[model samples]
Target: MKPVFFIAFLFFSISSIVAQPTQKPLLHGKNWMAITGKPLAATAGAAIFQKGGNAVDAACAMLAATCTMWDVLSWGGETQALIYNPKTKKVIAINAMGVAPTGATVDFFKKKGYSFPPEYGPLAATTPGTPGGICLMLANYGTKSLKEVLEPAMQLAAGYPIEAQTANSIERNKTRIKEWPYSRKTFLTRPGEKREAPEAGEIFIQKDLLTTLNKMVEAEQQALQQKKGRKDAIMAAYDRFYKGDIAQEFVRGCQEQGGLITLQDLANWKPIEEEALQTNYKGIDVYKMQSWTQGPSLLQALNILENFDLKKMGYNSSQYIHTVYQAMNLSFADRDFYYGDPYMPPVEPIKGLLSKDYAKQRAALINPNQNDPAMGPGDPYPFENKTNTYLELLKKRSFSTDSSDRQFMPTHDIRTGNSFNTSTDELYQDRLWRGTTSVEAADKDGWVVSITPSGGWLPACIAGNTGVGMSQRMQSFVLDEIINPFNVVAPGKRPRVTLTPSLALKGGKPFLSFAVQGGDTQEQNLLQFFLNMVEFDMTVQQATEAANFNSNQLWLSLGGTKMEDRKPRTGSILLNDNTKEATRSELKKMGYTLSFDDRTSGPINAIYFDWKHGSLWGGSSNHGEDYGIGW
Candidate 1:
C-alpha cells in the first residue's frame, strides 16, 4: 500500500476498535450560570450567581479572581465585553481597550533613538482598562453592589489553597516570576521550599489585591454618600483608583523604575463604545467585538465555510482539515493586511470580505492537492495590490525551527552590535501574543455587554512585581498600513488584536455568550467551536472537546530569521478500537498532519439556555486547569 493509504488505514482501524462515549458531564441549575478559564475564577462568578446576581455581576467577580490567579492577566490589562439583554434582545459591544498615553508617539520613540520597547516595559504599556471595563458593565447592567461582587474574590485571595493548575502555571512562568520582587515574594518562598498549590477545596488568598478591592469599595461608599447614582458612584470609585492616591503612588513607582505612564494617561482614558460586528451562520445570528481584536476574522472564516459542504467532507477527514486550513489562511491574510482601529485609515474592507459574493469568489481559489505557497485576499477591490504585498511579507516571515540553520551566523553578528537599532529592529519584528476575550449577554432587562482585554508580548522583565509586567500591544498598529495587522505598529494607532468575545441571539432571545483566547488561534478556534455546535449538532462540551485544527500560515512575520513555505497543520481526532482501516486510509490520502491526545483541543466555558428543559446548561473545557471549576 502507498504511504498515505497506510496511514489512512491505520487511522480508520484504530477508530473502529474503540468508540469513545459521547455523553459527558454537564452543568445544570436554576437562576444564573457562569464559566471561566480557572476553577477558582469560575467559583468567584458562580458565587455571585448564587447570590442572585446576573451575568454582569458574575463577570465582575470572575474578573477580580482571575486577576489574582493569573497575575499576567490582571486588572491593569485592557478589556472588551459583549452583553446581551434577554428582554431587549439587543447586543452591545463595550470596548475597554487601554489607550496609548497622550505622551506616546512614534516620533517620541524615534527621537529617543528607541524603536518600540518590549511589551512588558512602561513604554509599551497602555492605560489600564479592567477597572474601567468592570465599572462600565456594572453601571449599565448589573444589580449587585460592587462590594457584593468583589467580596468573594477578596475572601478567596485572602487565603485560598493553591491549586495544581495555578501551581503549574506558576512553574511554567517561574523564570518570568523570579524577576519580580512582589511575585517572587508571593509565589515562591526561600529557594528550597516545596512548591505549594491550593488543593481542591482549599482557599487561596491575595491580600495585596484584596486591599486594592477594599479601597475601591471605600471610594464607592464615599461617592454614594455624596448622593451619586449607582453608576456614577462606580465611576467615581474607579476614578479614585486611577487618578487619586493609589494612581499617584502607582505612577510614582513606575516613574522611579523607568516606566512611562503619566497622570494624564490615566485621567483622560475612556472606554470606546462601538457597534458589534454581526453575521448569520446556518440561520444562527453570530456577533463579535469589532476592530481592535480579530472578531471579524471569525465572521470571515464562517463566510468562507458557508461556501463549502463541510458535512459532506466528514469531520476530521483530511479534506475537511485542508478546507478549513485554506479558509483560515485566506481570512488571516486579510486580517494581517486590513483589520485595525477603525479610527485609522486604510481599513480592511470587512464588508467586502464578508459578502457572500466575495466569499464564493475566494472559495473558488482553494486547491486540494497541493499547498498554495501564498494565499491572497480575492480582489475586485482596488486595494488588492497593497494587501497582497502585506500577505507576501507575512508568508516570508513565518517561523520555523528548520530555518534556524539558514542564518545562524548573521543573527549572531547582528546581536553583537552595540546600538539598540539592530536589537529593536529584530526583536520588534518577531513577537507572538495571545489575548483574553470576556463577554456578557442577557435577553431581558435591556442590557448587552462584551469586552476583549489584551496585553502584548514580553516588554522589560521587572525584577519582582509580576503585576507590573509591561504590554507591547501597541505594536499591533502601524502607520499608512492596514488599520489592524497581526503585528500592528503605527503612529497614534492601537494594535490589532485576537481577543474578540462574541454574543449570539436566536429567535430574538439571548442564546450564547462565548470567547476564545489564543493569539492568532482565537478566531479559528471560535469559528470551529461555533460550527461544531450549529452545523454538526454537537453539545457545547462536544463542540469544545472535538478535535480542533488550524493553519499557522499568517504567523510567518514573527518567524524572525526562520521562515518557511509550508505551515504547520495541527488537529486532534478521536479514534476508538472499533474503526475500520479503510476509512483512515482515505483520510490520509487527502493530506492531513496528525496527532492524538486524550484531551479537549481548546478551553471554552459556556452557559447555554435550554428552553425545552427550562434550565441553563453550563459546560467547561477539560483541556487544562486553565478551564474547569474546582469548587
Candidate 2:
C-alpha cells in the first residue's frame, strides 16, 4: 500500500471507532435568564422578567405556571425556596412545607382503629403552605402584584396542550382519582365529557382549577377596591384560600371524609421566612433550609468531606464515589436520627452538627476498604445536653405501620385491598403511590431566586369543589417514632421534608442559583455539580452533563420505615452508561452494587452569573419537559 493512502485509511478507522460526545445547548444571556422543568413555565417566567419584574416576580410566575403544565406539581401542594438578595447580600430560606393538622396525634389514628396514619386521602393531608408562601414572597420581595405575576399561570390553567409525560401520569393515577368523587369529576372528566386519560397534544382545559385561581384573583381585586395596598391585596388573596370560602370548603371536605383537618388549622397557618443554614466549603458558601428538611444533610456531608482533597480523588473515581457515599451515609444516618422540626419538643441544637470539630469526628468513621452497612446516629447533642437521651425523646410519638422501600408515599398493598374505609384505618391498603418543578431567575440588579414547587396532582385527593388539594407530606412524619426526634409527628408541627432548594455565593457575591427535584438524591447531585465547577474547573453546562450517580445505601427520607430496615444497603450505585466501563466494573468489585441503566435524571436547573462579564450562563438537565430560557 502507498504510504499516504495507508495513513488516510488508519485515520478513518480510528475516527469510525470513536463515538461523538452528545452535548446539550447551553443558554446564554446578559439582561435576564430563567430555567424550569417545563418550557411553558420558563417562557411565562421570562415574560414576567421582560415586563419589568425582578427575580422573585419571575419565580412566582414560573411556579404557578409549572402547576398548570405538570401533573406532578400543583398549586395545592407545598413549596420551598431560597432567594438571594443582592442589596442585602443575604440568602433567605422559605419553609413552606405544610404542617400536620392541629388534631393530628398518635392517638388520633389509634382511635380510628388503625396503627398509623394512611398515606392518602384526607387523613394524610396537611394544611397546604404553597399559596401562603407564594403570596408572602410576592408581598415581601417581588415588585409586581399577585394578580400580575399570576396572570400567565391563570391563563395556562384555563387551557393548554397536554404533553405526553403528564398524560402518562394521569393514565396511571386514573384509578386513584376515581376513588375520590371530587378528584374524579375535576381531573378524569370534563363538562359532559369523559375519557380514560388525556391524550398528548390535546387541548387540556382545567375549568375547575381556573375557577379556583380566579377566586384568589377576585379576592386580591376586592382588597384593592377596599383601598388596600398591593401587599395587603396579596395577603387578602392568600386569606381567600386559608380563611375565606375556600378554607370552609377545604375543611368541610376533610370532615365529610373523616379526615382530621379543621377550620382553625387553615385560619392559623402561615408560611414562615427563616434564616438559612450555611457552611463554607472551598471558598463558596452553600446555603440551605434548616433542620426541618434534609437540607442540613448536605451541609453535614460537605463538612465531613471538606477535610479531604476531593479534586485529588478525581471525579466519580472509585475512591471519590466511595468517600462521598460514606460521608453521605454518615450524614443521612444523623439526619434520620436527629433532624426534625425545631419548634417541636425535644429539639436538638444544630450548632453541634455543623461545627468543624464535629465534622472531623464524623469523617473519621469512613472505612476505606468497604461500605459500612450500618452507621448509627452521631452524638450531635451539644456539650450542655450531653446527657440527653435522644432516643427517649423520640419515644414520645411512637406508633407502628407497614414499612416499604418506596421513597415518598406508600405503595398499594394488594394484601389489604382498596377501600376508603378509614373506620378500620386500612384506607390506604392496596393503594400504591409514588411521587420538583424548579424555576430560577436572576435580574441585572443582583436579585436571584431558586424555587422548587411540588405536590397536588392526580394521585392527590382533591378537596370537594374547592379545586384545591392537600399534600401528602404527612407521610414524611414517622408513624412509629424512632431515634429521630425531629421527625416525630406532632399537632401543628411541620414534617421534616425532602423538598430542599439551594443557593450559593462566591466572594460574598451572588454566584450560583440552582436546585433539583430528586427527593433525597437532590443534595448528592447538587454537590457533584458544584464540585465540577469549583474543583474541576468545568463550565456550568459541562458540570451539569457530567456523569451522575445515586446511592440508595441510606434509609429513604420521604417515607416511614422500621429501624431494622433503615440500615444502609451494600451501597447500591446507579450510574449512566456514559460512565467508563472500566470504572463501573472496578466499583462493582469493591463490593458496591452497580447498575448501568438510564433513568429519568432529575433536571438540575441552574444559572451562573459572571458579574465581571455581565454574562449569565444557564443549564437544564432537559429531563422530560425541562427547558432553559434567557434574554
Best by TM-score: 2
Give lDDT tens digits, candidate 1, residues 545-602: 5667545456322113111321222221223222246645654554433332233244
Q: lDDT per model, in order?
A: 0.58, 0.74
* Off by more than 4 A, model 2: 1-22, 110-116, 190-195, 383-386, 391-435, 559-567, 599-601
lDDT of 2 by residue, 152-258 (tens): 98888778887755665666678777788777776664333455767767777777777878989999999999999999999998998899988888888777866
Worst 10 residues of 1 by lDDT: 408-417
Output the TM-score of candidate 1.
0.78
RMSD of 1: 8.6
Q: Clashes per prediction?
A: 87, 5
Over 4 Å off, model 1: 1-24, 102-119, 168-175, 181-186, 189-205, 379-472, 475-492, 556-600, 626-631
lDDT comparing candidate 1 with the true structure: 0.58
Under the 3 Å rule for N, CA and C atoms, how many clashes does model 2 have? Answer: 5
